[model samples]
Target chain A: MTATQPKPRTSRPGLLGIYRSDLGKKYAMAISGVFLLLFVFAHMVGNLHAFEGPEQINHYGEALRELGEPLLPRTMLLWVGLRIPLAIALAVHVHAAYALTLTNLRARSGSYDGRNYLAAGYASRTMRWTGVITLLFLAWHLADFTWGIKTVNPDYVRGDVYGNLIASLERWPVFALYLMAMGALGLHVWHGAWSLFQSLGINNPRFNAYRRIFAIVFATIVTGGFVTVPIAVQLGIIG
Target chain B: MNLTLRVWRQAGADAPGRFETYPAEGIPPEASFLEMLDIVNERLERNGAEPIAFDHDCREGICGSCGVMIDGVPHGPQLGTATCQLHMRRFDEGDTVVVEPWRAAGFPVVRDLMVDRSAFDRIIEAGGYISVSTGSAPDANEIPVPKDAADAAMDAAACIGCGACVAACPNSAAQLFTAAKLVHLNLLPQGQAERDRRTVAMVDTMESFFGSCTNHGECETACPKGISIDTIALMNRDYLKARLSDRRLLGRS
Candidate 1:
């Protein structure tokens, strides 16, 4: 077989790779898992500045702006460039997850017998649904903040991003949505963090205790950081 | 203790199986679940009936031959014990324990509870071994594996080729079992020579037989040794790296 010739994608036995056959799906998950994990850490750091005063948080955002500084055509294009790939990654991860889930559900049509507790963790079991909700929240969050599309406050400005955030969170429904999205983010991180260690071949039975502990700690930090943003903004603390 | 049992019975591979109810009256509560089945078989034999053909060997739970769904849960309702290791004391008196074989298309039922797990052997044959020739054994400490790597490899090696993961997983994925083999062989220095080839062959074979993982935690939960789902992730990373990094395969004949 020459290098230029396209390699045939062999379909393994058992109906189009339901549950066990698809190799691409597994790596799609792993590679995307790495990217998503990086996004989580970056997002957490950006969110942590909220715990300081409003100026500190806005300064952090400004620092982010400095990375893609020379805004030639549009200032918001910098943010859009960063977000587009993240959105694409999110779309692939969630779409593959949903497709894999549907295939698995069909294959195991006769076998389910209430072995809910037999699964590895609560997070793994609910990964599909949680992924769907997280995607929806991501779209809404982008419109509300990134693109400055829809906000409760019509006076939302482009470069005045921090002020726009403060105004948006002051509304009861917007605050509630932020809280719910953060909770979903917490669930995603709780399992994904430890699983990343496993993917990178860091699993030791002895160190597994450490891995679980770190998972909880990381989950807590991300959850606390994101949740603090909305809560602080809603109150008179951040504005 | 007297208990009711609904067991799946099929005479041959082609025969369709169904649940048959049997009233089992046992005097000992400390007997293993398989021992309880043995007691029921003894009675069947005396009555000029063919014994219930369930798979078991080395009742110590190390052989991985004995596996069954009991009361809708694999290996009964125990947290981390296989059927051979599960005791009768866990069940209440007069309880109805439903028993069934490991049901998956890849594992066809050969007898009553004996499904052909040769698929696992086939997967192994596809490339589950180190290619070290039959030569003199190397020095024990020659291949100095790091403590962490050795520890992790041993943990992965803990898997006993049991179909419990396949049976328990909603997707019937052999990722845990296949991954265990991948991790154990890929982690050691001796196994490093065949590392790239090992991952591609084993994982490709597994993909040919089992379902893809959707991050369901059932396999880890059903595993008697508490093998984590992270093995699947490691296998994924290794396979991807191998696909890109295998230098020998780049310009070879």
Candidate 2:
């Protein structure tokens, strides 16, 4: 056979090019997902300090503002260094999720007439629905606790983290909504943790079992930990 | 065995397509899926109708040319079997199988049950090969590959460019096909020289036309060759490494 001339080398895609693709979006989602996971886990642990008493939990909330005090202005370091990055991660995660969903919708113009999802799990299938729920829940959570929005939390007070949590959870409807959101968070994190490793290219058959266990355990702990707070408050254990 | 086939038909790519039901009678249980289609087509031809235009070559299931959604499952319900290899015995008499083309924006239908998978070809053209100098065969012992690596590479190489992974995926992702190609080459000694370049180019090309892999595992199920999703993980690793390192090689200061 005659030797064919090699084609000219195509210019390498830049970082922007990488982000434009489906794989790049997945990487963005995974990396940002890790950041969000860290924040979620930390938030759950911080909230769990409420079990000790109002003083312990209140101090923990105050410590967040006092982070990096000598080197930086009050609350400046936490807001600038940590919160900003977390916000960026959340933005990227949501953006990528939306873009991927649109692309996926376009890719398959129509569903199968007689379809069966043999291999897909409940968590995998409900990712979009859970994601939307989590987003809405996040907004409500921030409004009620962080921003002290009176409409959502009539008794919300600034800097009084423990009191605010109890006042919000005192309402049965609020407690139920919080519990439902945590359930959605549990499902989201369960699938995200398991699949994030694959997105980051760490999958191996040998470690797959461990991945599954980690996802379930981590999701359960975070969700269960958060759920305990409202239940504790409602039961007057912490209130 | 007698069967009812709701086959999708389209006059052209721009034209609308719809499912047309037809009776497939007196088909032997031993006949392959394509053979059953052949009998149906013969009857349609005798009745002065336009015979179904489907894609098939190498009915032995090696070429990866034949594929259709049977009862909404790519390559039917048989695991790890191609459409051509699926026999009528898998379906019982009086079964109503809904046959449709691989429905994806990237894979447009050319006619009845045949899709234009040239997007896959474009991905291959992007970078699915090594830049080997044309010459006589090199000695087998020149560069010895580990037994496991060779086996793994061969396993990934088993992909026949079939679009079942795309069809089977809800997201219509081509990660399985692209990963198979990338792993088949990247695992080998010859392929190492351009591994980074190949990963970036091929993945970029794939993302242009396909959906993202959400770890749905449907691609592995739809794969006639039973290609593992592990290959996709390997490809992701390589692409990440390539994006970071390949920039330096491009003389970007």
Candidate 3:
């Protein structure tokens, strides 16, 4: 009846409702994927410090560890401030991904009919599994390396973080775990990075080939770079 | 030139589909893709095997009925051209061609290389048309449509509903098809009344049948008409507007 309104009201849900639908879940997953890729770049840069040898790497680690120290003022809490946002971003990213997978599965209603994988690559097809495997690897890495709570070999003490890493890599089982985990990371990065570009509407005919090349180059560098450290340690290339 | 063709063969809708290999002989490089298929089918008929049951109504490319996943690419390696318009010169002599029907859950295989695209029909039925009445045709100049708007409408109308978009999409999403129809119909002044209803009904119907669009540009790449994914964004915008607008004025409930 108001001038702003046109006709009689209906019972249908509003535009907000559309954003809460199944399609909305995908949009959330897409937005959060950007955050996850950012985290990967930061993590990779942190890992690269290992290449600078023990003194540089250990100092960097110690600096990161002191970021949230209680003696520091709120302005000085760089790591703590960043960690909170990163945690939220990671949560939304992982939750949205799982929700989307569940929605896809439910929409199909438990059917395992044949699917075409031609327009997709192996990494793109196995995103869900790769994501899960990477998550599990994260948990193991945090416990073994970050918390210093577990050890495959009791003789390996945790005095030096760098020495601990080398000793852990020397153990076949630990090295195998790291290799498998890095493989998942490689797959995750390959597809996730490409999909992020697509979601943001930046992926077009002109930039598609470049985006693909970047994804491959990034995946190879990160995965290959991380694996080298473990391999070098296992082969006694580093102390 | 001689070429090896692997065409999908199925006896009926319920029957299992399999690839049947055949040799394409004496094919002219200038002939259209469908003509090349016809040559292969002629050889199959002579051998007493059932000719591949692919769909084709207008070989001139207007009808949008003829399509096949050619050698792993929808509508062949050529971009922006339909399968029927694609020339044989694109392929090398003695090359192997793999042809299959449009792969989608909504588009079930009816026979060899023929999928029942009734799902698209159902989506159209859901709300593809305008409710405007016709008497004597109005003068074209009576409506003052801007040049840009008319051009965009034509662009969207260019979608042939060949399901190439669905096949090329990794998610097998039909958003491009649904959005094209919605945008094409809603752009004109006549389609204004039913715009809201059309967007909602068509999008809901599409979701029930086809896979979700993940915004990948693969469909845009495979579309014979080169329908832009921008239509999907338009659909989203209209659907959002429709939610607040009254249903009675919009017509259909």
Candidate 4:
């Protein structure tokens, strides 16, 4: 756009270049991953209202519905500003994961017949599987709670967040599914939290320990907070 | 040490490869891995059989020419040791040792345990160097590199161009190798002029045939020189600066 600008050193095709290159795809994945991580953490903290009894939990749900009442409108800010952005983030994360999987496969022209791993942790290796399971769990979760699908949760009430949570986890099979999903989410976060820093080029040997501790603690807290409500309901502590 | 070798036998790049077992009996424990292979090849030739094909030079660990997946671990189970430095004593009697080439799209099998690692040369050629006037070695006093930068650069410079990092990575990523090469030069004052161009060009060349890094730490474990993964973070920083800065990488400006 300027006369003094230097010549194009790369044929890097703009935004499309991000998707075409290996590093750019990771940047997309890591950036989107950050939003998803924040969403899950905030979701868990909000859900902790269930411990304060039905009144607090239901009020928390209504607060979300009326996020920008006077300034904007009921649910306007929540849907347009938060939920829609989260959905896009999730979509981008999934897209990047799918593309990278193919690249990794092709790069490995073929593996050694006796190939074995030395330092790749189980959580790092099982990211794709855990990621898929997390997606499936998200669908079930939305149906049972957000969409109020009768078949997914017969006792789901539109605004009764506490009642819906209790009714859903009361079923043994549903409880099992939630627990399994939490395990998968924990593993995904463990690898992803640290990986995001590397993908973003914000790393050094000096702060590696802090990065590790953050990944473990974040994974633990997020998984623990979300699962606490269901376990409390099952134990009759919330009733 | 008496070892049973399950060595991959391939005639050429396009030839059908298979495991060809051979007994390496009465081998001295002190003999290097390549030396043991030498003994095996000598016996095979005496019996009118084709010797195993492999790459080796400067039996010392510095050359980086010799390497293989010894029992599934690149450069064998001995950590921070090259295949040339790995000794037969690392094995036991009657052990079944598996030897295979670095199997990656970027590194095709030439024959037997030998792989064509020319992909690495191409990556380096893309940028891994600084432009110089090619007269003679400049006086060390002319350029005063800070102690920290010099040490870090030396650490990166220890890379031997071995493909073990690629062979060990589950994704076959050359990020570690490329990072080391980039860091070795990018950290110096001499590399400032073309730093951004070198980073972008080398990284693009690397991704052409290799996979992306996922921070598995496998490459560091399999690396003979024990190069740290922090170099990768540095390369990432350099690349982002080049592509995201206001300076447009536009054509012929």
- Whose TM-score is greatest here? 4
Q: Could you tell which candidate, 2 or 3, scores higher by TM-score? A: 2
Clashing residue pairs in candidate 2 (N, C-alpha, C atoms within 3 angstroms): none
Candidate 3 chain A: worst-modelled 10 consecutive residues by lDDT: A1-10
lDDT of 4 by residue, A73-147 (tens): 999989998999999999999999998989899888777777778889999999999999999999999999999
TM-score of chain A of 4: 0.93
Q: Is candidate 3 or candidate 4 better by lDDT?
A: 4
Candidate 3 A-chain TM-score: 0.80
Quality of candidate 2 docking, DockQ: 0.43
Each candidate's B-chain TM-score, in sequence, is: 0.95, 0.96, 0.94, 0.96
Instruction: Record all residue pairs in model 1 with backbone atoms less than 3 Å apart, i.e. clashing.
Output: A19-B211, A19-B212, A20-B210, A20-B211, A20-B212, A21-B210, A21-B211, A120-B217
**On a 0 to 100 scale, what is the lDDT of residue A85 in model 4?**
100
Clashes of 1: 8
DockQ of each: 0.18, 0.43, 0.10, 0.42
In angstroms, give how far residue B7 of model 3 lies from its true place.
2.8
Against the reference, the lDDT scores of all candidates come to 0.74, 0.88, 0.74, 0.89
Residue lDDT tens for model 3, B167-241: 776566788899899889888876887888888788767766666665556788888888887777677667656
Query: What TM-score does candidate 4 reach?
Result: 0.95
Better by TM-score, candidate 3 or 1: 1
Q: Which candidate wins on DockQ?
A: 2
Q: lDDT by residue for model 1 over B1-253, one digit each (tens)?
A: 9998888888998888777888789638999999999999998899998788999898887888899988767777886878999998999999988888887666777877777777688678867887776346666476678998898899999988878888887687788999989888888887888888788777776655566675656788888877877787678778767665655756885
Residue-wise lDDT of candidate 4 within B1-253, one digit each (tens)? 8999999999988899999999999999999999999999999999999999999998899989999999899999899989999998888889999999987878888889898888788788889877775345666547889999999999999999888999999898999999999999999888887888888889988887688898898999999999988898888888877777524545645
